[model samples]
Target: MYHNTKLTGMVVYPNDPEYQQARMNWNPFTNAFPIVFVFAQKIEDVSNAVKWARENKVPIRMRSGRHALAKDFSQTNGGIVIDTSHMRNVTLDKKNGIAKVEAGIRVGQLVRMLAREGILAPFGDSSTVGIGGISTGGGITAIQRTAGLISDNILAVTLVDANGEVLQVNACENSDLFWAIRGGGGGNFGIITSYTFKVRTAPSKVGIFEIIWPWNQLNEVIDAWQRWAPCVDVRLGTILEAFSKANGLLHSQGIFLGPAAELEKLILPLTNTGSPIKVFVDEVTLLEAIDFWAPNEPLFDTQNTTWSSTWVKSSLPEDGIAAIRTFLERASGSESNFFFLNSGGVMNQIPPQETAFFWRNTRYYMEWDASWTDKCETQKSIKLVEQARLQLKPYITGSYVNVPDLNIKDYGQEYYGDNFERLRKVKERYDPENVFNFVQSIPPAHICDEKDIDD
Candidate 1:
């Protein structure tokens, strides 16, 4: 059903050699085949692609860094895929501390460019992730405890709406669209061409802390952390990342932002709670720390792994921790444990209702992930993952929309929570025709009556 017409940007088809790379995303399980691919070069190219897809009744999939690991949400079989990779453009203004970045810019690329000019924007932990996708779905960064979500620093955005009209929106202009793009969801309202964000001076020195604890002592460590991690001062950002070790040891990597002596002071309580197998803390430049936190190289080649996330008020209770230990210990040990990123510092200081991101009161946001390369072990990983979820479901307040599992039956409850209705109204006012549609994308209020059944 897609038209073969080409606009300003180049178009690729299924037979093209680059098709495979174009259709690929961060999620290994997602392999899609769109009828055509638009390598969007300019803002007008994006608008033309949207208009073309709408007129041809073709489903459109918007992609930036392809970091969305969820299936269905960004996948479209035999549909039209709008590739934003070619639209890379960055403008930096040191005098005003503002940077205008095209949606296609990668986190690492942005950091490298800004560091040259003595400025940096707060973004996700990964370097390859595109600013476009992360900003729309509750962007949390290592510095989030100090600076808040990436959306919080956004000054304005230029979005090409469903009607093929480019609208420059911000707090003072097209405020509703601005609200939706901040935390509602990307690809639902429009294709953001560029975003203007207030940048800050990069921290000259940052401290990172890593520790490995025995599996038997996880409860003591997590419980102790639950009480102390949230109360840490705003200058120090901390995270309790739990993971299984290849050497048969369970590890908890704690990342901190401050001097080495200061980091030691913050982690002394955790060390006293449980003896760790190995503990290392050091100070590094902000750029070097970002490289240290970037995902490993082999990660780029792995496929078929599953990731899920949910926000929690505090550490999982004793019963919840016991359930997790049981699941991780008995479930083949192939799956990694969840993480409680401390989010109660500057993150909580922002009022819950200020922007679309509503987890301000929550002490921690947890990411449940299960990664495996063996096709046969998929079932084992999935079952154990579900077991972990079932145990922690009662304690979960909400899920991050970006890291959702397509298999989740009720998405509204998992992602948007109480803000679903308000998001629906924003969608109605901006994308009434559903021209900007994806498999699990939010629907406008007028059309939500039909789609709500699926939710």
Candidate 2:
């Protein structure tokens, strides 16, 4: 491998001792071995690695937590992988309720650091997911209903552009770049090095809920959830996840923030609609609440899975719910989960045009996820996700970027909607050469469409 061994950061080849660990990401399905893995130790190391990859004419795969769903975004067959896991650093400005964190930090790492200071930032679901990817792609957290997404909390960021020069971007300086990073998906603009965010103080009391029902009742529960979940108080947010148990049974679960009594009151509608096998709700510290819903790691051990999702302006109608029910009943062919995530919390408080994330009119975001271990079974799992997507397509108006599955055929249009053009102009002004291109990259206007380009 052509590597600068004398460089400060460690370089690992396929045969290196840490190769397997370095390549192992949250998403185990990505199967690619870069010629060289640059384990960058510092900001300058990240810049140098990027410069090296550019000079070598090598395709680059940058990893921050490596939870990316698309194999193309985090894996390259024979290229350079810039591994940033070692650069985790968190500094809290308690007075300002803000935290400055390194790109390599994970949601759990940052949360723990901030909790020590009685501060909180709206990060994504998993603690292992790197903040760089999460914040850049518009992070949605359990706390989103209260403080907005992690991207919305971004007060400043130091990113390395295509030219390998670091630029400080924020609301005032490099504002366009800042907007793109908030929700435009990462790797399309630049490599984010550090993010300065406006963290919020945690609520004195946080609530938790875990409920499960029979597979047959999914339609009823979903129909009821879609009607009531979003209308819950802004102090509360709900994530309804449908999953299969180890015994080959399907289940539905979620997380909410509020007092247990109040949460139970809000959830009474579902209890009345369906017969649940398990139901538990309680209140706990905002920090302790993290483990209440799921104290253990929640990811399945499978690489080959297909997940597709979209947003809807209104709740699914009876026919829509019926279609989803049909799919859910048939979804036992593989371990699949259909989820509904309510969007209005602090997210709605911000105007749709204020940032690139344009799901304002949509009340909910939905996902059809399927996972399997065998490659041969991949087709079956994919079909389940596709069936769900097709059924919900009529109601889906837009999409979310952080789910890691950016398979929307017309990615730019679906993910960004009306904001696609503005993001493209920012892409030109910042990384004109498309140095940050990837599987779901925002292509320049001249290369894709003329009317979309901004002056």
Candidate 3:
């Protein structure tokens, strides 16, 4: 009964030779074993897989690039994992400044392809992260201030819902679903198979700079960066990172749409703040700037790590900066560090209630992660990340959905903020049976007494 002709595509079973490799996650900490993996090569394959899963009564999890930070974010112990890495197709409409892309394309591949046409699409730091997974959860990139989030650039999407029906969702049709999927988290409302994004023109060369200060100057650097980054010229996008004491680094790097001379002039306030060890600024190709910010190799990465993040409503005071320094000092691994992204400009032009992304008034986004290679260091690393998040809760407000953390109890509020309740209602419409439910997946709205649902 389950061998339906529509269930087409490469399927890997538990006993298959490729099953072990196919089921591997980008993050090694998320240990899971799925019954099967349906590698979707087309929209029909996605539809068929959903129908088959429904008949077989198997829970389904959506996976692409396998880079979900939270455990169980993209896989399950005894479920069907729909892996959409085979559908890498794109149609570029340069005249209209639009790019229609398949769901499985990684951020790096897409950006490079568009760069050849002199088009700049918003993308994240990692080259291997899937656009579907990240964009659906509000993709943040270095150019976010100038271009807006990846979600904001989306003009439309092709989705396969819980009922095995393919639907075209946009501002006109299925409008509510359109708003919900943008920044509401992927696989919560439906399976997005393709997206049409509004891209922008790009200069052949832009200003790029990297400045580093001694580890001891981190506190002052943090304070100076907080004041300057968020309010910098919209043409420039900035990021600062503080490595664990073991690495002894406090680096600030960014890109300016103008020449290196202009960028250098714009960043004098930061350089003049404290004693600096090294400063470099110059004109570079957009691809070169993308390569410079990349931390991991442009390939599927496997590492044991735990991550937690929150948005800053205001600048962190001296005490807050001290707390960040103290917690980061506990990290001993080379990969452990605290990262920051300046927020504002085009990303904030839309108010909170306009879309599922609610943290529009944020100053910057901050996240601290702990990494370890030794099995002996696992517990300590995870515990440190959790404790660090709790300690810094006073300084941060909302959590980032793409960078999921199971430790956050009130995840609905933490991830979606004021948009949580409306997201629940959209979940009620598209996935009323909760067929796509997971740890932090939105649940259908409950029509009951307010008292019964109070936290």
TM-score of every model?
0.93, 0.92, 0.96
Q: Top model by lDDT, which number?
A: 3
The TM-score obtained by model 3 is: 0.96
Q: Which 10-residue window in model 1 sums to the lowest lDDT?
A: 245-254
Clashes of each: 0, 1, 0
Q: Write the per-residue lDDT of candidate 3 for residues 1-455, one digit (tens) a residue.
A: 44553557999999999998887777878858989899999999999989888888889999777888877878888898887889989999999999999999988888988877889988777888998899988999889898999999999999999988999999999999999888999899888899999998988788988899988888989999999999999888888999999999899989888888889999998889798888999898877777776544635455588999999989987778878888779998877899999999999888888889888898999998998888999889888988888778788899999998887777888999999899999988989888998887787897333432332
Off by over 4 Å in 2: 1-8, 244-257, 293-300, 332-334, 404-407, 449-455
Superposition error at 352 for model 1 (Å): 2.1
Worst 10 residues of 2 by lDDT: 244-253
lDDT of 1 by residue, 130-204 (tens): 888888877888778877888888899998888778999998999987887877877889889889988888767
lDDT of model 3, residue 90: 96
lDDT by residue for model 2 over 333-442, one digit each (tens)?
A: 34566777777867888887788887766677787777767668776766767777777777778777766554457777778889988888888788777777767778
C-alpha lDDT of candidate 3 relative to the true structure: 0.87
Whole-model Cα lDDT of every candidate shown, in order: 0.75, 0.73, 0.87
